[model samples]
Target chain A: MPKNTLGEHLRQQGMSRRSFLKFCSLLASGMALSPALVPRIAQALEATRRPSVIWLSFQECTGCTESLTRSHTPTVEGLIFDAISLDYHHTLQAASGHAAEAAREEAMKENFGQYILVVDGSIPLDNPGFSTIAGISNLDMLKETAKGAAAIVAVGTCAAFGGLPKANPNPTGAVPVSDIITDKPIINVSGCPPIPVVITGVLAHILTFGGLPELDDLGRPAAFYGQSIHDRCYRRPFYEKGLFAETFDDEGAKKGWCLYKLGCKGPVTFNACATTKWNEGTSFPIESGHGCIGCSEPDFWDFGGFYEALSRPTGQTGKNAVYGVAAGTAVGAAVWAMNRAKKEEAVRGHEKLTMDELNREGEES
Target chain B: MTSTEFLLWVKGTGFTLAIAVFAAGIVLRLAEIWSLGRKPDLAEAKGNANTAGVRTIFNRFIPDKGIWDRSAFIIIAAWFFHVGLFVVIFFFVPHILLIDSIIGLQWPGLPTPIVDAFAVITMVGLLAMLFHRITQPVKKYLSTFEDYLVWAVTFLPLLTGYLAYHRLLFSPDMLLAMHILSVELLLVLLPFTKLSHSFTFLLARWYNGAISGFRGVQS
Candidate 1:
């Protein structure tokens, strides 16, 4: 077994002690830990042996992997990947076919119940033929690989919430990892393509604390998904002030007004995109004059039209109102006719009697 | 279903159903009232009924000094509740967007914080009115189950909207769904209950003022 502490790996890569400490502090802050915990994180990560990470891709676009690897070199995410033993990855691994499968099998056996299993896409339960790696079905491979994992990391919205594949009229019957795996501690890092730092930040927390971080209601790390994107967005002031962009190039848009009027789902979406940002803290979707599509939330695709305002209905409400008016008018006219008939009946039934008739009736009695 | 899915349902199908019911009920009730035509006046006209009716619609917004002095608490609470409800509903950005979608009429909205303050005031005012109804002997005696039901339905939207805005008591999506659901309930119930006063009060005030004006008397 190859045994190397992360400290030794970093040192060999020419990362100085000061730089490593800085990285630790950065990681600590990103995880929302106090400054006081920096030393403990540094010590734990330095002394800890590299953990084996088996990356499994099933029914995914390579976007989540690209999100992590595409970061500028020497960034914290790249460094963390360098510090771990990545035994098998379809995209990044040098091995091919049998060799890659062999490496995965060996890693699972060598580090049984110790390796971290990172899943990037959803699992197809409909048919084994739908998604396969080396002729092994995604479901079969997942069930096999998940048996020995210390903890599972569902890396993107696909793996977390059965993203596009599980959208309306889902053909492949794709489902999230949690739908199948019920016995392990699964940490969901949900986004269309999760922010790179957030991906690394979660791994770092595990590396330093040797346990999963606090999770929110959806099994997402609370540190990143605790607050809503709208709450932390820089454009929040515009929302509060009621300045909204009516169109793509309107005055409000030019003035950096809130995109709420443009179908922004920021109010309902919870993610670190607004604060942690993308492209290395450069900008997120909302900052670029576009509304949030709520990529992080479950069933986002089926919620409604992406360009439709969150406050607006997805169906033909106007048509419904028109029909309602027609129906109401019909009912009203009928009721009116009935009431008029009743009144006319009462008038027709009215009887008049004179004092002479009453005197005659009294004499007869 | 997930909270997001629940939210979508309320915003979509549920909203459509509520608006349809509201529109139909209003039309039916109005038709029923208008069908009951008033008796024609045989006496000579002493005043212009049309002018008096239009004037009374605006004038009835404020009560006479005698009535105001006798029911100051009820008046103040009711006014605050009404004004607050109006501001929060029409001046809030999200609500404006909703209305604009339906009617194609857009308007600028007050700042969110200002609307939020109005929501709080609305809730407080509603609570005060409810308390008065329960505590005051005459009010308690006169009140029916419909009165309390209307009070609850009216107050729920304000409460839920406030909670959703602050993201309190539940997840953001869930709270927002609850808020929309509450509003939909109010719409569905409005036409059936005395809450129809929102529309009927106009006709009622006009009728009263027109009658008084026709007799050359102040109403």
Candidate 2:
């Protein structure tokens, strides 16, 4: 069966080698690798054995998984998923209860220190009863599964940054995968549900490079998180020109002006949404006439309000400007009045200078 | 601090400081000038002072034919520079943004290409004015070290802004900081130097018109 290699598997599925190579190049571009590396990526991917990927779902809505699967049919992302041997995914796998657990344990032992651990959702530590896989709590299962894994990919905001589950007044005591497993090299693919291509890109990088890609300060792949949404946004020119839509459905909005005045967080938020986009490059949030909710950044939920403009000052700025103008006006007005009074007094005291007085003053000088 | 942090300081603490000094200094200087009032004319009355004051504001815009030959270069250059400066100051996107932030009022900006042309014109006009001042006999006699200082302060913001936008000479943060710092210097010096003309030009023109009108003849 020629070892059922990726190249062999694709050939058997009736995919041309050219199509497979094109997919490899696309992945290379997504990872910000030079075009010259395309051939190398193709060669490496085709010859390589499929790595076992164990996807764990804890306190999540399965949105991340759905985003990965439902975006497009027969696409590069789907193909990459097909190429990898997904040994354990509770939702996707037909194996139930004991069988699923057995598969995960068997994969960990068989591919020990080589298998990749992909996690969605945060781990609940407050109580073992909050979430469980079979009879095991999420915390125990994650900790157990993390051992012997080569690396962990935190696949959603919840897994990456304790997202909605860890928002203010959190009840589940949900902590991100990084907090629980500090020993593993964790890459965060963070969004409410991360853009699907971003997930595939991370997987492709690991599979081809045999190591994790370079990451930013937040543990997100730098190729995707390198620029702010504002820097790459189509509406940036409008922002620079100080043209803004005051409200949704206003004339300015209809004219496609900047949404800065209507509380766009594009300026501060960094993600690939502006560049990579969602639903196969159809449109991003700003394109649909809505401001960014800053889904990728940490603690985005607590940034006051989504509709509140970022231009609005938070502290003493307003008071300071008012005091400045008032003090300035008062001083100016007082000085103006004094000057007027002096001018009036001078008028009152004025006398015509005769020729005799001018001659006398000149002679004295 | 990092470049971004430095930028934040300029936008926040630095901006407020400049505004305070600019506002207060302008008031004080204008007050001082206005306090030295002139005596009323006794020989007057063909036209009202108020009418003449308003008339003079517009009248002085067009120079008389007699003195136009000697003062033509100065007047034209100064006019060009002043108009260019006005356009650059109030119409540039960044400048408008700053104004919006401080006052909560905002308006659309001109196209970038137009703003760029105005900036170039302003720079060239300022250079021409400076050249005329240093070379001309009468203007040279009037020029002082303080005048040169004011000129440098005025020229710096525009130059640094150009460099920053084009990403020349330094990093983006450093260039932006330099641009801001130059503007701050200009704001602080405005009342103390000849740049006070920005506020005083109208008042001076009004006074001249009123005094001439009081004499019942157009001077």
Pick the DockQ winner.
1
* TM-score per candidate, chains pooled: 0.93, 0.63
lDDT of 2 by residue, B118-190 (tens): 8788899889989988888888998899989988999999899878755576655456667877887898889
User: Across residues A1-365, which tens digit of lDDT does each residue of candidate 1 receive?
Assistant: 24888888889889999999999887787777899999999999998889999999999998999888886434677778877789999899999999999999999999999999999999989888999999999999999999999999999999999998998888999999999999999999999898877888899888888899999988999999999989999999998888889999999999999999899999999998888777757889999999999988988887777888888877687888888889989999999899899989998999889999999999999
Task: List lDDT for all candidates, in order.
Answer: 0.90, 0.81
- Give the distance in Å from residue A1's predicted Cα in candidate 1 to where it truly belongs: 6.8
Candidate 1 chain A lowest-lDDT run of ten = A70-79
Q: Residue A129's C-alpha lDDT in candidate 1? A: 96
Q: List where candidate 2 sits over 4 angstroms from the true fold.
A: A1-23, A32-36, A46-196, A199-203, A210-246, A255-271, A292-318, A329-365, B2-7, B35-46, B63-68, B71-74, B92-109, B130-149, B159-189, B217-219
lDDT of 2 by residue, A157-264 (tens): 899988888876678998889999999999999988888888888999998888998997679999888777887999988866667788899998999998876778
Clashing pairs in 1: none
What DockQ, on C-alphas, does every prediction get? Answer: 0.80, 0.27
Once model 2 is optimally superposed onto the true structure by TM-score, how far is the C-alpha of residue A323 displaced, in angstroms?
1.1
